[model samples]
Target: MSRQVTPRAAPFRQFIVKVHGRCNLACRYCYLYEGPDHTWRTRPAAAGPKVLDQTATRIAEHAARHTLTDLSLVLHGGEPLLAGAARLAAFAERVRERVPRGCVVHTTVQTNATLLDDRRLAMLARHGVTVGVSLDGGRAAHNTLRVDHAGRPSWPAAVRGARLLAERYPDAYAGILTVVDPASDPVETYESLLTLRPPALDLLLPHGNWTAPPPGLPGRGTSYGDWLCTVFDRWWSAGRRETRIRLFEECLALLLGLPAATESLGTEPFTAVVVETDGSIEQVDSLKSAYEGAARTGLDIFRHSFDQALNHPGVAARQTGIAALSAQCQACPLVAVCGGGHYAHRYRAGHGFTNPSVYCTDLQRFIRHVASRLRESAALTSGGATR
Candidate 1:
C-alpha cells in the first residue's frame, strides 16, 4: 500500500513495525499480549522470511522516492527480542542496505528485557538498533503486574537482562518505556528510574478505554493525572540535567505555547501504522479498544505491499480527518494539545473513537499540573535558566 506516490504531503516521521509476535517474557500489561487481539496465536511468532524480504523492498522503494526527513522504523512485537539475534541482525542489514542514499533508516526496538543480554546487545549495536527496555520501575513497582504467563515475577530476570544489555552496549542502549501503575508510589518509582539515567524515558498511560478501564486506574477522578503529576514533579526536577521525559516534554511544550510534538499525549493525529505478525497492517494496536477486529486492514504486507496498503481507502480514511472524530473532544479546551488522545482510545462498544479519552479529564488535570509547574519553572528562572 503506497500513498499516492507523490512526495508525501509530509515526510514519514515514524513507522512501528511488528518484527515478531513471540516474546521471551509475557508481561501482563502488554497490549499486544494481554489485553486484546489474540490473533497472534495463528500467525508466525517471528517475522517470516518472505515477509521481511518484501518489507525491505517496499520500505526502500518508499524511502527512495519520498523526501523523508526522519523515517524511524521501530522494531516492536510480542517482543522483538524473540526474533533472535541472527535473524534480527540480518533483517537490520537488509534494511540498511536497501534504504535510499541520504535517507538514514533510524532503527529502534521496544522490548521486554527478559531476552536482552550481552550477545543481543552486541548484535543490536552492530545493526544500529537503539534499544529501549520496558520496565515499570524498581523491584516492587515492576513486579506489580509485569508477571509471566505462569504468574511469576519477571522483575529479577528483567533487571538482569537490562543490566547486561546496558552494560555491554551503553551507546546502543536507548531508553525506557515505563507504564505508570497508579497504585505505586510515584515519587519512589520516578527516583528509582532516575538512577538508571536513560537517554530518554517514555511514561506510558495504562492501556484500556471507557468500556473496561485500565487496571488499578479508575474511570473517574484524576487518578492517573495525580500519579503522573507526582512523577512529573520529581522527574522534572531530577531528570538528570538533560535527560528527556517524553510525556512531560509534551506537556511543557503545550504549556509554553508551543505546538505539541507527541501524538500519543496530545490531540495530534500522528502518522502511526502497525503491521501485525500475520502481515495485517492497521492503525496502532491500541485501537484494540475499538473491537476484537478493530485494527486489521484485511491485507497482508507480503501479498499487498505497504505501497498498496498505504493508499487503501480504509487506511487513508483514519489517517487524516482525525480532528473531526468526536464532538466532545472537539469542544474540549485541551483539544489542540491532546488531540483527543490516541485514536484507538476513542471507543466504547457502541460508542467509537469519538468520545473523550478515558483519561481525558486525567490528561487535562495532568496538563494543568505540568502547566502550573512550568509557570513556576519560568517564574523562578532568571534569564530563562532555572535557578
Candidate 2:
C-alpha cells in the first residue's frame, strides 16, 4: 500500500478536468453555476486552445510521474458541451497523443443533454469517448429543478436530445445521470430512468458540505437516505443485469466484501483533481458551493503546464489534505463503506472540511443496512449459516 508506486490506485486514479466553464442551461442545483459560487462570471466562457494544450501536457506528466496506466479522466464543466467540437476534439487528441507510456486514457463527458446529437456523438465516438447525460429524473421530478432562466421546463428538450443520441449513436452514448432532489419519489424516478434503459445511471446527492447541508425540504433533512433505500430495494430486486446504477452498485459491493469503483462514494481517497476554465486547479468542483472560489488554484491553465499545476502547492494540498481527514473517518464503523461521504459533505466554514459527514446519521443508517447484509453474507459463505 505504499504511495510511491503500486497497482493500488494513487489516492485518486481519476481527474475531473474542467475544460470549459460556460453551460447551456441554468439548473437551480448546479454546483458550478448557481449552487455555491458565481466565479464562472469571470472565467473564460470556454477553454481556449492554449489552455487545452497545456492541460494535456500536465496530465501526461502526472501519469508518468505516478506510473499510472489506464486512468479515468472525466471531462467535466459547467457543461463540457459548451467547449464546442473543435476544442473538445483537440483536448481528446492531446490526451491520446501525449500521455506517457504507462498512462492509458479513457475519456467520458458529463453533459446537460441539450447539445447531445449525432454530430456531438460522432465527435465523441471518433475519439472513443463515452457520454453521460444529466437529467434530474422523470419530467416532473426533472423539470422542478432543471429549468431555463425563463422558468420553462428543460425535460422535454433534454429527453429529446438524449433520445436523438440514443437513436443515432447508441454505441457512443453511455448513460443517464440524475441528481436526486431528496424530495422526488425515488420509486418513480428509478422506474422512469429504468424505462429509458440507459446502459448506466448515476443518482447524485445535491452538492453540499457540513457548512451547508444539501438543499432539502423544509424539515426533511434525511430524505436523501430514504430516497436511496427505496432505489436500493428495487435496484437489487431488478438483478442489475442490463442497467447499472453506480451509487447503488458501490453500496452493494461494499456490502458483499467487494471494493467500490469510485473513491468519492466509497473507501477510496479523494483521488480526483479538477481544472477550471481559467486554468486554476483545485479539488472537487462541488466545493465551489461551500465558498465563492472554493475550486481556485493560482496557476492559469493558459500560462502554466499541467505538471506545474498538478504539483503546485494548491493542487497537491487537496490530495495531501485528505490524510488529515481520514483519521476521523478511518475509525468510524461506516467509514470503510461511506468513506466519509463526499468531500463537499464534510465542509464547514470555520472548521473547514474537518467535520463529520453532513449525511452523518443518514450514511450511518445505510451502513448498518449494508453491514447487516455483509454479516449475513459472510456467515453463509463460512458455513451456510445466518448470524
Clashing pairs counted in every model: 15, 6
Q: Lowest-lDDT window of 10 residues in candidate 1?
A: 1-10
Model 2 whole-model lDDT (C-alpha atoms): 0.70
TM-scores, one per candidate: 0.90, 0.86
Write model 2 residue lDDT over 62-119, tens digit each, in one string.
7776677677778888778877755676688788788777567888888878777778
Q: For model 2, what is the alpha-carbon lDDT of residue 24?
A: 67
lDDT tens digits, residue span 1-387, model 1: 343533333334566778888776666556766666777788787778877777777677667666554577888887787778777778777977888777788888888787777777888888788888888885655566777778877887788877776567778878888888888888888777766667788988877887777764445578888999887877777643646888888877766678676756654435666766666766677766556777777776666655555565545544554455588777777666677776566567776566777777788898878778877766877656743
Candidate 2 wrong stretches, greater than 4 Å: 1-12, 217-221, 261-263, 302-323, 326-330, 374-387
Model 1 clashes, total count? 15
Off by over 4 Å in 1: 1-11, 216-220, 239-242, 312-318, 382-387
Give the number of colliding residue pairs in candidate 2: 6
